[model samples]
Target: MDTAAADGTAAGNTTGGRPGRGRGRITSIEVLCAVLLLALLGQSWLRSTLDVPALRTGATVFVAVCVQALPFLVLGVLISGAIAAFVPARVLRKVLPRKENAAVGVAGIAGVALPGCECASVPVARRLIGQGVAPAAALTFLLAAPAVNPVVMVATAVAFPGEPGMVAARFAGSLATAMTMGWLWARWGKLDWIAERALRRLPEVEPGSRWRAFTETARADLVEAGGFLVLGALISAALGVLVPAEVFGVLGEQIVLGVLVMAVLAVVLALCSEADAFVAASLTAVPLLPKLVFLVVGPAVDVKLFALQAGTFGRSFALRFAPVTFAVAVVCAVLAGLVFLGGAR
Candidate 1:
């Protein structure tokens, strides 16, 4: 074909061809418009159908959870950003003990300073290992950073309201779980289990740009964590209404069964550590001890944390660590709950 004719044909195709592909690439605004249109069309039907007491209660609970938790989530992500972008890794190196066992204890306690979620901790832990910190120490920080942080503690307190013991139990259980795992790793963990990639050092962000880095980091984390928190609220609300009340009463009596069930639920939910408190609090069916287990275990060894650990530390590390962590967290949580919350009632 002549150059002019070919150019004309290309222009036409660019303007009008591949209609199906264009339609398939739907934008968020387009989806919103479609949803609005459907809502308008089904307005009468929805009004009649959704007027049931159950649906109203569920919706109210869902909204309440999201509203109550979102501000805390924002606060957590902001603190996480400050830790990631403002704090220098050199500060950790100087602060941690030279002796491996002592370092593990220090690292576990240092978790109080970093308010990031489990997902944020994985990369930081891997970087710590790469930067010549002991693997056990880094792992301790990894486990502790999410569960024992101030933002998460605040959220737990808010979620449980007057139940000050729940806050204490969760804090003690999660810290104990992290420290125990660290000690176990120091004694028996093999270096070969870690992937080499996890040992490579990451580039440090420039100190001067920390403010910009902080805001950007906070915004990104908030967007990702917020979506998961909203989803968790929806699921908790739905389960609140759908699950039979008798089920809770029966489970409440079976302490062991309730503990195991909540642990399993923690793994399945894979909730953000900052928001899991509200979800756990919403489950009034189980005893306080089980709910305590759920809060403690969810942040330490959920499916999300397992996957992140596998990707960063290697499959071998995750397989061994997750199960052990799960067992330890359950035991610690049950004991702490008994001590703080008082005898599974």
Candidate 2:
């Protein structure tokens, strides 16, 4: 009687466990099916909604900008990777001046060599700082690389057509902004504001494996910077459509208003430095000074650049650096414009 009762109890337990296990499997399958259905519905909704003219234009512009900028960004990352893999940190330190101020000047001048957009410069600058290069110098490179590079200068000349002076003015204004900011930081910037981990050099790879290191570094930077580039392009394309073209038509003789407007536009648009010159040239109602300001401020301090800086240098540093760079860039651009483009046409 006891054996029969025990066997019956075991049978009851087994029967109860099976349904619970089956219910769990059924629930999981239902959830996965629901997710797949939702995704399909969302995709269909997006296709219908994005058929409007404004959105279509925005999408086209976004694609064009991304296509235009990707090659330059890839090249910049490759150079950065080469520098990381081939150049020892000690070699960089030896090349840069020991004095922070002198190093800052050199760094600003060195910007002429790198010919990529602001997206490419942030990681390279962070790497420089990590290699024990002075923060001030690294910051200067961050500002100057996108602004004063030969590619940007050439593009400015091409965009402006007859104006050789625009190229000269852009170069001067950008360099001045970068150098001035570097000096300011050298005098009063606190070291603690930078993330501690960002300051340390990366672990050295084996000498024989440098080629592998180069490819890996380049690939990583390309992936990271490419994401930000796409985002910035989207933002620019959206603003291009949403902001009325007629708004720029009314600023006839308002020099101060134009400068302020252009500066604000520069920050909001966050156009690539290489491409911003063409956009500025297209704004026929805007004065040369304002256009110059747009070119300078866009490269040195804009929405995208601010995001990049904050991500790399920590929020505290970016908060301080971006505002100061913006103000300096605006002032330098105005001064350079007055000298080069003049107050008139």
Candidate 3:
């Protein structure tokens, strides 16, 4: 009787333990299946709800921005991963100038080789910083890569046909903004303002495991940066739809107001640098200087960039850097315009 009772007790314990282990836990796959079922059930209602013009417009802009930026973002992360996995810090230091200031200049010039938009540059810059590159030089490349790249230049030229001066002015203005900011950060910026995570160094990759390190780093950065990118796109689309059209009508005759307004709009719109020139060109009422300001400011600082910067570096760094960048970009654009566009065309 005693042996039989012990066996039954053990059998009961085993049976009870299995259900207890999974009592309240839900797997991701189960949650996903439930969500899909709900979505299918609400398909008609969801379609009707999103059918409004404003929502439709916002949706289009959001999709356009995401579609345009995602490829470049992917490219940036892949390069970043390669840097982490393969490139030695010593080699990067050797290739760049010894002095931070000179390295900033080199970085600015190097920007011309990357033909991607602003989204592509951020991850690359962050990776450079993580890999022991000077912050000033990496920051310069961050600002310049999207602005001075050949694709952007060609787009600018096509947008403003026969206006070689606009193209020249844009290049000069953007380069000036990048280098100036780099120098300023070198002089006054604090490393502590950057997030600890951003500055954290990865463990050295074993030679045989380099590819594994590369893929893992790329995947991690993509997942983190991609969320901020989507958030920026959503904010930009909402602002784009909400801003009144009358604002453009009022600015044509007022050069001072136009420049300031256009600069603000550049920040708020968060247009891709490669595509911003066309949008600026389409604003027929605005003068050339204002359009130039828009083009320069959009790439250097914008809502999208601010979000990415805040996420990657930290809120403190973005707050300080973005406002200063905006001011510098505006001043540079105006000066470049005076020199190249012959005082606002």
Residue ranges of candidate 2 with Cα displaced over 4 Å:
1-90, 204-246
Each model's lDDT: 0.89, 0.79, 0.82
Q: What residue pairs clash in candidate 2, if any at all?
A: none
After TM-score superposition, the amount by which residue 307's alpha carbon in candidate 3 deviates from its true location, in angstroms, is 1.6
Please give me the total number of clashing residue pairs in predicted model 1: 0
Model 2 poorest 10 in a row by lDDT: 16-25
Off by over 4 Å in 3: 1-92, 203-249
Question: Per-residue lDDT for 104 in model 1?
Answer: 92
The top-ranked prediction according to TM-score is 1
TM of each candidate vs. truth: 0.91, 0.71, 0.67
Across 174-282, the per-residue lDDT of candidate 3 in tens digits comes to: 9999999999999998999999988976455589999997898778767755775576677657656786767655676778899998899889877767566756775
Q: How many backbone clashes does candidate 3 have?
A: 0
Please rank every candidate by TM-score, starting with the best. 1, 2, 3
Which candidate number maximizes lDDT? 1
RMSD, each candidate, Å? 2.8, 7.7, 5.9
